[model samples]
Target: MRGRTVVEFHGEIDIATTRQSDQHLDAATARSAPSVLVDLRGVTFIDSAGLGPVCRAWRRAVDRGGDLTLLCTDTRMLTILRLTGVTPAIAVTGS
Candidate 1:
């Protein structure tokens, strides 16, 4: 994990926190890491708005020739991401 950076997301995620999350996600992904991990293990609830920042951060990492992976274990959140077709866009793994 020396060349990787992990950005942890905590608690519930909704439209109210998108801006803050996006800002932090952007900053984390913008760092000089070969891979970026958006850790969602601590997140309880997530909606479409929550997915936006994660997707955007993934795109930013990809545009910089880096990989952005998601670290998530919650079954429901994983199901939501899968049903929304976001799982295929970025690598999703467990801690």
Candidate 2:
């Protein structure tokens, strides 16, 4: 069976919710080389504090030889990722 997991996040993502977000990402990516999809379509806002978990999840998936895709259509969020150079390290799909 192909192991794939999807994590959906909503509302604003910041320091107040990083830990919770990280927990969700960690659980989904913990499986062996899982194909993880992070659905950020519901996220209305994100800051550097929020980006930390995304980066960490990406690194974890890469280190485990897995694949991770980010789903989002927020121009602001995309801009932030681009400005931070995180766009190069992760795969993002407009949703």
Judged by TM-score, which candidate is best?
2
Q: Which pairs clash in the backbone of model 1?
A: none
lDDT of 2 at 45: 87
Badly placed stretches (over 4 Å) of model 2 are none
Native-referenced Cα lDDT, model 1: 0.86
Instruction: Tell how far residue 18 is off in model 2, in angstroms.
Output: 0.7
lDDT of each: 0.86, 0.89
TM-score per candidate: 0.91, 0.93
> Tens-digit lDDT track for model 2 on 1-95?
78678999999999999999999999988877878999998999888899899889988988898989999898988898889888868999985
lDDT of 1 by residue, 7-94 (tens): 8889988899999999888887776544888889999999999899988988888887788999988899899999999988788998
Clashes of each: 0, 0
